[model samples]
Target: MNQVGSLIFLVALFLFSTFLNWYVFQAYKTVLSGVDSERSKQMLNLIYWIVFGGISIWVVYTFHQIFKAGEISTAHQQVLNVFLTIVVTQLVCTIFLFGEDIFRNIQAGFSLLVNGKSETSFPTRLKWLSIIAIAISMVPFTSFVYGITKGKYNFTVHREIIYFDDLPDAFDGFTITQLSDIHAGSFKNLDAVKKGVDLAIAQQSDLFVFTGDLVNHEAGEIEPMIDIFNKIKAPYGQFSIIGNHDYGDYVSWESPEAKAENFKKFIKQHERLGYKLLIDEHVVIEKDGQQITLVGVQNWGKGFQSKGDLTKAMEGVASENFKILLSHDPSHWDYEAKNEPRKIHLTLSGHTHGMQFGIETPLIKWSPVQYRYPNWAGLTAYQGRFLYVNRGFGFHAFSGRVGIWPEITVIELRKK
Candidate 1:
């Protein structure tokens, strides 16, 4: 955006944030009114100002750097993300308090109209409502704290049993473990990261496939975790494909040569991590006397990079083959894989990361990203072709995950 537009947007955000802080302060003052502990009240007041002051200073500093650089650095962006998480979560708590206040006001209005005397006078706070508000505020506060501390590395294995009528008896009960979007650059906790990697290794699936996104922007990011990633193994083999981030497209480079060099390094990093980097190529997995085709293409999506070539990948494969295609973005399944004449039985993807935050349970699953991508996560099918978008092995911009924890997907192939 232009400088004027950016400044205006920043000012508006600051105003809104200030208003929320004021609302929080007012509610807090009323809540602490009946309490006798002066020290508790003082501590609360100190916390309120410290958090607000820190956020304000962060905002000003971030905008100043953005204005000077004409773009935000990764560190600045991460700081903004962390700060916004706190601000937005607190704002949500404030909104709940406002709702309670509105309800109490309505009740008072009704009492005044009916009995000519309201239960409480104007500006009188309901102690119960205030208490409820405080309790409600702790929900997001605790949840966010958990997200930062434990949620990111809390890897869970999601298993799916998919059956096909085109029976390959030899391949029945075959297990394939998929891990995608290991944005190594964003990892901070080495021990926690190693724990997640260990979980993936423990699965012991017959085959392992890393759909895409080995690094966030450059290959060097994966250097530290090279040994940890190499621990992941399967009897059949481990294969991988490129994602948009692997190309180093998001950041500016000193020259075209540097960008090309970075891309080459990313390729080598995949090799170092023991992934048979496939680029618009096909491989056959043979077990006993049956065979299934596994094709991989470069990163492709409707709105993303268009380097993947399904036609090239499926060159020698027949239409009747039990093909499992690996393309990073789930959108590729919608636009190309499912529509291919040579039917792709299953497509693996992991670009969305379910926005790295959402409520996913057996009963109710929902994420904001669902509105943008039809095949956002989990198993989705179109015209009998299945697409499984792994929730991702790691996180990205947000740095932490909430309800949507890091995922390790294990798919068992059953012949119907």
Candidate 2:
């Protein structure tokens, strides 16, 4: 499921660049087709500014990412941030630039039909028509970009669940902190990662869970910052499950053996950080005489092929215990996900990253992922179970959260 998002997100940027440039080129061609009057020359000059300069800026940013992808440091982190900001701004600007011409074209079309000007200049007629489709689609894309940048991420908890039966009476007020999709990359450095872990610790959570994507594609991208997460403290335990990114599938692997070795190493890294890595297994957390089951599964998704084996994970388990699932993608919930025959009471997932863009507010919130999952963020009830789609403690390819600030979900599990 995350791979779907990654492919779409990466494709969106590329298609947008290609199509935008094409439309602009088409518009530039029209402007030049007419006579070389003062107005034609003026329009040509303005069009050149938009085309050549835009291409130049685009080239610099793309090359910058290529050049700096291997060097993960504080300075490069800043560079990535600025680079993303510029690209995002350009995405927004392109829609508007293309749209303006589109609107003008529509007006010209209508003018030709009603006023009967069949012989309108090629430049005048073509510019408007070339931009018509671009303008319409840009409306929604612009709205998405604007809503994300301006802060509009609206979500709600699902209604299939009411409460957890195994929550201790004394723990009616207990809050567990959940972190997910912390991709720590060239964009996110040690200090930023520390700030998130530190904030999670400050919640004084009864338990803490990281549901994968601790690092983007590279396991060692976070090696230098391992000690920072090791600083996190929790009473019950700090648990983690692997996300898709942990599998080393993002980069080429020499052999199946190498990929397996890398995944094992990632598990070891989490242990070094004082986290109890749950790879298709469950551990009982007991307080006083009461106990709850904490289950961890590998990255599983309905649309993505991966190593998550939920049944094998629950194999030796007794159904009497209260279970909290630490799976990566929310789509797992759809596979009878949270509502599977196993009767999982609470599931924590974080692969969505809230799309790393969008706004969460009292009303009218959305993200590119909203089209996929219903509970893309926060606590929700599902078929008599609970699922928390955490917004995540870290950012990925894009640094800043346009509207949805990174979240540290403190979920309170109260006894019925």
Candidate 3:
């Protein structure tokens, strides 16, 4: 957005947040009613406002920097993370407080109608309800703190064994390690990142594919960690396709040539990292005289970039050959890949990052991203074709992840 538009948004957000804080303060006062020491209560109230006031200043400064630079630095992102955490926690508290207020007002109204007089001077705030609200608010408060401190780097490996009826005999049990959305610019802990890379290397899969989003905005973001990622080598080869962010579309550039130069550097970084960057192209992986097609396309999605040319990428490849597609966004599979006449046996993707937050368990696997992209994370099959959306290897706009931790996906292809 333009500077004026961004400024207006920030002002509106500030006003809304200020109102939310005011409403939540009522709950705080009710919860503190039992405190014996007036001084202590006063001090506590002062501290609460001070903390939120400081957060407000930080947020304004961070946005100002973003407006000036056309990009958010890692430090600025952390500020946003903290701001979001606080706002969400306050909103949770507001929900409970608002509900209780509604109930109390209704009770008061009923009493006035029935008795012809108000039973009480005013509806007293329920201390116990306020306490409960505050207590529950801590859950998300602590979770957000932990997510920032540890969850972003808590790289989890997800393994899926996909069965295919037309799979090549030589390719049975073939494992492909997939990583996506590295967003190298967001890395804060190099040692932790190295551990995730080490884990990917330990998988020792036959092939390694990075779906996309190597950097947040520019190619230079990964320059510092090229060697760290280069460690992820496989027996077949390491291949990559572009993501929406790699084109430098999110940030401002002095000229079109500058943006083009940045993209060129991004492509060069892939080469330096020992990955064969594919743009609307296909590579055949041969094992024991049998071949499987690996088709990669540029960032194609339902709402994002649609530069990926599936037909062009599949040219020359036999329709019967077992196909594995490297697409950044799962939407591509939902909209195009799965319905292709040539029949893609498998498509690997990562762009959602499972929204970096959600619950995933044996009985419940859910993230907000699912509402946007149906096949968000893990394995989903349609008409015998499989799509595995890796949660991502790094964080993005949000400085950290919550329940949906960073992921390294390993898919074992088995012949049905």
For lDDT, the strongest prediction is 3
In candidate 2, which residue ranges exceed 4 Å CA deviation? Answer: 1-162
Error of 1 at 253 (Å): 1.5
Q: lDDT of each prediction vs. the true structure?
A: 0.85, 0.69, 0.90
lDDT tens per residue, model 3, 8-70: 978987787778778889998888888999999999999988888768777877887888888
TM-score to true structure, per model: 0.87, 0.73, 0.94
Residues forming the 10-long window of minimal summed lDDT in candidate 1: 117-126
Candidate 2 worst ten-residue window by lDDT: 151-160
Provide the RMSD of all predictions against the true structure, rounded to 1 decimal: 3.4, 6.8, 1.9
Off by over 4 Å in 3: 36-43, 117-122
lDDT computed for candidate 3? 0.90
Candidate 2: give the clashing pairs: 105-128, 152-359, 153-359, 153-360, 154-365, 333-337
User: Per-residue lDDT tens digits of candidate 1, residues 1-416?
Assistant: 57898778788877877777777777778777877999988988889878886787677668767666643456875776667576756677687777877887887787788777645455466667766776777777777678776888889999999988884899999999999999888887888889988888898999999999888777899999999998888899999999988888877688999999999898888888898999999999999978999999999988889999889888989888899999999989887788988888999999999987778887988888999998898998787889999999888767677888899999999998
48 in model 3: Cα distance from truth in Å? 2.4
The sequence of per-residue lDDT tens digits that candidate 2 reaches over residues 214-313 is 8776677778878887888788889999998777776666788887887778878898889898889889888878777888999897676467888888
lDDT for predicted candidate 1 compared with the true structure: 0.85
Query: Which residues of candidate 1, in runs, are more than 4 Å off?
Result: 1-5, 35-47, 63-81, 104-125
Q: Which whole-number lDDT from 0 to 100 does residue 202 have in model 1?
A: 90
